[model samples]
Target chain A: MVRVTGVADETPTVRTIRFEDPGMAAALPGQFAMVWVPGGGELPMSVMAGDPGGAAFTVRRHGPASTALYGVDRGDLIGVRGPYGNTFDVREGRLLLAGGGTGMVPMMRLAMRVADPSRVVILMGARTAPEVIFERAAAALGEVVISTDDGSRGEEGTAVDAARRLLGSGRFSAAYVCGPEPMMAGIVAEARSRGVFVQASIERPMKCGVGICGSCCMGDRLVCSDGTVFDGDRLAATGEFGAIYRDKAGIARRY
Target chain B: MGLATRVAGIDLAGPAMLASGILGISMDVFRRLLDSGAGAVVSKSLSAEPREGYPNPTMAEAAGGWLNAVGLSNPGAPNFANMMRGAPGVPVVVSLVGSDPDEFVSMARLFEGLEVPAFELNLSCPHVEKVGLEVGDDPELVSRIVRSLKGAGVRVIAKVGLGSSDYLGTVRAAEDAGADAVTAINTVRAMSIDVHSGRPVLSNGFGGLSGPPIRPIAVRCVREITSRHEIPVIGCGGVSCWEDAAEFLLAGASAVQVGTAAGGNPGIFAEINSGISSYMERRGYSEISEVRRAA
Candidate 1:
């Protein structure tokens, strides 16, 4: 069981919950844990770098499990298992990270892990001003550019739009992304046009965080094992990457 | 010869299959496993309606195996049947679970156009209520389910497990009702508790255990079922290596299914197939049937 040591509001509905877990801390930037709320259900949360030798998960207050998790504060205990799935493969030189809402968690963590922090450029996306989270934390890691859909933040468009504009202006060694499927697909396409190496962390309805359950499947890849983070070339090859995904019921749904 | 063999009326390129609940349901995954040398693949058990299954802590590793209470989450028959559209000859066995005989037969018929080799009647799932072992425990219900499916012209394989009632009786009922084959043993009923938390590890409190720990029990059940009835047996549980596969075959299982182990090694099918071929050559056995005869 992991005890919450601290909680901080990232946005109106999002909170960053901190806990000390050696395995989770050691996990790669894109991996996640299956956090089991005491009496509630378990949900997968992306692993984040925490202060004083611990790990953290950023939760957006929605759904029963996430709401229960969002309300947890200091000393609250929750069952956590994993550090499961693949991670972001760090590359040298300039790196571009783009994400929105809670999807920014892994991108922010990846920014911190890069060898040359100053070379990391992040395009943080949100719907409005208050929803743009961790701007200072991201800036401290490198360069942070915020994009809000309503034009209340840094840029007056989606991260994909901001990224597309930036792609022509500069040469990034690689691009890392996380967000809604369409958003990631857009950034990946932009990155591909510029011949940039890209990696994207995908979110699937996961039952078993382990590889056995087919709930997290995308195309032929079991997201829980093959990757929560997949390379640009790999993603581009799988038609299901941005097109079709399975819900908890195992019914295919288009993004 | 090669690792090729036959289970009931179905032809298997190898004797190792991808067990249900382990990356099952996708015809794409079945094709991948088939390409990787698996004999066949079983889809996760499906009911009349889709099930979301139990929440997390559904699986816990303990006591030399995995304890799981996934609650048989699956897309209902219609959705899965649609997924199988135009993808024939994948050699997948559809596994069905429900509260009664009519439910099983109705589900089997949904895949009529898919050429699904058989429906593996899941009468042994250990965690769920009303169905699974609860229904399997009643010999009358077992007969009715198998008979109904057979009457609908659906080839069936009865998967038996250790429940409160005699497993032998379950096998007998399935055989008498015209089951094509029997998969001896589902996961063994088991649980694990966290000492510090003073609570059960699995959400269901208790779940079914699979992996190295249950191999002997599964082997014993297979030997017993094969000896008592004419039903061919497909042994499941704790089959991680070639020797385990060979052991099951020698004990009279026509095919072996791997679950827990394959989660880590997707190449297990190819590994087991090669190992079995080596075992047959080393033992001077030309046929899989010859190995059973030697036993």
Candidate 2:
């Protein structure tokens, strides 16, 4: 069982839950942990911090489990089952971490892990300025770029649009992206067109964080096992991840 | 407590088989399910050739379940045959789907001498525009598909999805077509809309709903099908616990397939298996069939 030590609202829609599990806190960036909220059911969440004792998850209160998570206070006991999936490869050079919505959480943690803070830049996009999460904390890690869809704050457009502007001004040695599927796909497509090395975190209905249940499958690949973090080329090659996936009936549909 | 059962001469130590289309298609994930204690693993639905499937977002969650519109994506039979070599100890049920009788016959013949334990004719996929539920809705197509697979020397289980009517007709058609058993029900036709966008949540605009939300409908399907046909019934959808499994058995299913619930907890299979065993012991019953219709 994991104990919740801290809880903070990163945005009106998203919240960050900090736990006191040293083992779970030590999870690598891009890897997710399953937080079992007792009767509410277990769901996979990405680790937003490198420290195990004070691990955090930035979750959007969209569904029942997520909504219930918002009500959780400090000292709540939640069952954690992971530190699962692969981690991002942090290399030295100009690194651009771009994400939208709650996808920015892991990117925030990735920024914190870089040895040289000056080499990293975080470009985040949200629906509005109020929706931008982890901005103050992210500013301490690197240059933070914000974009909103309605022009409420920052530049107005999709996150990929913001990433494009950042890429045009300078050469980025590596790129990491996470967000809604279309947004991630757009980032991957743009990164590929520019010959930039990229890795992305993909989301699905993850049931078993350990990869046995098959709910979070993208083709034959299990996101919980093979990756939430996949190389841009690998994602393109898999054909299943970004393009098509299997439905409940074993039918394949494009996404 | 013993959770073992037999299907077509194959002995399973447990009744909780991973239904087709979950994670059973991949050999790597299939191996993991066995390690996690699944009695058997059903491979993804395969056809004569490779299928590219439909577009995304193909799945969305509703109040009590999920809806998906995956259009039967597969690597084809010949490619899948290579992966079926030297599988784990449990029975390997290869699920096959096709557009017509000839395609079904050809696909079944491809598995000839491959030593698979069973052949599940997937006549129930709800997302395809044609050749799936359309054919399934017509008993003649189901009979034709099943008849084509006859003499393949493999146990045949016809899988059918739930519908407004014709549920009993489809089951009878599979029986008439020579299916040895039947599995019911696949996802129900459903849709979810993103309120923010004022559009359907799935890219396909609609999908098949599964999980706890569909349990009652699946149970009704099992009861109706099993009561009409002598063939064994494999109850699926929303079976997350022993009580749920027991409910399926009492409703007349010989076995049960755990899907979305298993997705949430793969260990639930073993847990359900053990729970069923304990319940059986407490009730002074021996075989799972003994509890069939207990309700």
Candidate 3:
């Protein structure tokens, strides 16, 4: 169990719940925690670690689990079953992070901790203006770009638009991504086309939080243990990226 | 000699089968496990209808290994059948769980066209209610379920665990009903309480314990079952290393199933297979059958 150190409402619908966990300090971006929200339940969440933020999971308030987690405040205790899942292979180079929805959480952490903040470019996507989260915080870390589906923010189209602009311009060492399958798929393709190495974090309905239950299956890979962060090569080999995902019942569905 | 073995009349390349509900349940993962060195693999128990399953905290690290009460969450037999379409011939066993003989038999029939080697009747799930241990405790029900599946020409293996009633009777019922073989144990009924919050660790209040802690009890069950009946036995529960797998064989099991322990190191199958080969050399045994109980 860990203590909730602070809570900040990133947006109207999104909130960042912070915790004081020394163990999580070592967790790289895209790694996760099976955070048990006291009386509510446990869910796999990407742990966002930064210097000032310490460690936290950003909740978007969608389901019963997220709703309960979004309602948490300071000093409350919750159980953590991670630092689970693999981490991103961020090296010293010009890094690109493209994320949409709650996927931006980990990218923000990447921006904050990358080897060279000056060489980092972070792109965040949301549906509308108010839905745009962590804009103020992300700007503090590196070069920030925002895109919204309805054109309510910085750029109209999607994060793919901003990503295309950056990757098309010059050489990028690697790209780290998270968010909706289609969007991540687009960004991954764009990054790869430009000869930039790419890694993507994926979400699946997980039961045991540990890799054993076989719940968080994404195509052929167990998203919990094998990776929430998968390289472009791994994703391309399975042909599951931008194609299919599994639900809680182990039912395969097209993304 | 090679690490080749057979259980329930099904030829398995190795003797170690991946226990139900490890890593994700997909044809892709199954092929990976087989290629990785597992003899065969068991799917997580599927039911008549899709179950959403229990909330979080469904599993916890306990004294021996993992304690999990996943509430039998599955994609249902129909969906699983869809996934199994055009499946390659691997020694994959589909585990079925339900309330009655009809549910079990009907679910088994859904895989009729698939190359599924066998159906493992999950009569031993310790945490669920009205099924699993509940069904096993009722010898008549066990007999009917196994008999109905066997009557359909579908190979059946009844998995049994310690329950309120005599678990041996459950195995006897399966044997008398013509079950192909029996997996001798399931996770032991167990729980962990969080004194900090004064609540149970698992959301289900209690769960089945699997891993090293249950190895001794599992070996004892396999020994007792083999001693009493001529039916083949597949020992499961708490088998982490080849020594544990060999111990099960020495206790009279024809094969072994590894759970909890394999979650972290899937390569354990190859290690155990290698260990078993060297063990055969050390004992001068030629096959899995020769690694039997000592007087």
Candidate 4:
């Protein structure tokens, strides 16, 4: 169990809670943890940032689990199960990093690991400026580009439009994407057509946060264990990447 | 010189069998486990048609264990068999879950000539309604499911767990029905409630519990089954370390199936195999049966 050391409200509905755990710093770029709030249900969340001092997870207040987690005060203890799943391969050269909503959480870590931070271009999109997360931090790491549906941010269109302008440059060797399915699909399609390698972080209804639960399966892959990160070719093969996914009831909820 | 052992007439490289629910989806996952030192792998429970299972929040954390009501999600027997066409050469056991004897018979027969070595009747899934504990609770149903599968030329093992009826009685029914082996204890029926939400944690009101918390109970079940009958017992539940595996062996389990422990680390199979082998060497036992016989 880790105790909450700090909590920062990034937005009206989103909060970044920092915790003290020795193992937190060891979490890889794409691995996730099952955060269990005592008396609150456990849920999977991607680690946004971590170091020896402590680790932080940014969550949008949504469900029962998130509500309980966001409500935790400093010094409250929460159970953590992982840092599970495969890590993002940032070994390649210049990369395109695109994220939307909380998907930007892991992208920040991936940005820092790249061989050249200057070579990384980040495209983040949200409904509006208040919803944009990690803009300053992401900008400090590399060139941060933003897109909001209401044109209250960097660009007038979606994150994919920014990705399209970046991809047109043809300088990037790979594209790392994590966002709402529609945005990811748009970026993935554009990147694939350009022949750039694309690694995507996917989301699914996960239970065990380990491979045991079939809740996170996409194609033959158990997303919880096999990946939260999949390459462009692999993601394309999964029939349900952006088309369909299961809800809390395990019923196929089509997007 | 050999780490190999035989359970229910099937040769295994080691005594670590991947439990029914974990990593049972694809041949690639199975081959990965085989490479990681699993002696054999069990497929997810298969019914007549594909089951989507329960909704999200299907799993939760308990004191030292996990509670899951995954609802036996699978791609039906025929679909899974088709998917396993490319299965690597390893001893794969198919766990079948169904409501009646006929369903068991047909599903077992569907996997014929698929290189599957045996069928494990999932008569003890505590979460599912008509297919699991409900079927296992009735000794007569257990007997009929076992008999029907056995008559299909597929060697069958009955997986028994705690239910409304006596678990030992269900084991007895399987034994009388000519089951090749018995896996003692599936997950125990359990639930977790979120005090703040005042609602059940899992989408399903209840789930089956597995992990370190259930180790003692499983050990007791293994000992009871081994003591009362002459059937081969595959011990399951909460085997995280080699010592736990040794405990099950001492309790008279011919082999042990690993579940919750492997969920955290798939590489645990190799560690457990080596740990068991080293212990066997220290004890001056050339074979696993020596320890079982001593017990």
Q: How far out, in Å, is residue B1 in model 3?
A: 0.8
lDDT of 4 by residue, B137-225 (tens): 99998888788877777788899999999999999999999999999889999998866546777778899999999999999999999
Ranking by TM-score: 1, 3, 4, 2
- How would the candidate models be sorted by DockQ, starting from the highest? 3, 1, 4, 2
Candidate 2 at residue A107, lDDT? 90
Give lDDT tens digits, candidate 4, residues A87-112.
88875677889989999988998886
lDDT comparing candidate 2 with the true structure: 0.76
CA lDDT, every model vs. true structure: 0.86, 0.76, 0.84, 0.84
Instruction: Show the colliding residue pairs in model 1.
Output: none
Between prediction 1 and prediction 4, the one with superior lDDT is 1
At residue A240, give the lDDT of candidate 4. 68
Off by over 4 Å in 1: A50-52
The digit string of per-residue lDDT tens for model 2 on B223-255 reads 887777787888998888889999998999888
Candidate 1 structure quality by residue, lDDT tens digits, A43-114:
889988766579999999888889989999799888888988888888887889998788988988787777
True contacts kept of each: 0.49, 0.14, 0.60, 0.23
lDDT of 3 at B207: 94
DockQ of 2: 0.10
Query: How many steric overlaps are in each model, in order?
Result: 0, 14, 3, 6
lDDT of 1 by residue, B1-295 (tens): 7678888998888899889888875677778878988888889998899987887768877777888998888888888888888466676788999989878877887887786888998899999999999989999999998988899987899999999999999999999989999998899998887766678878789899999999999999999987878889999989999899989988989999999888857899999988888888998988888878778
B132: Cα error in model 3, Å: 0.9
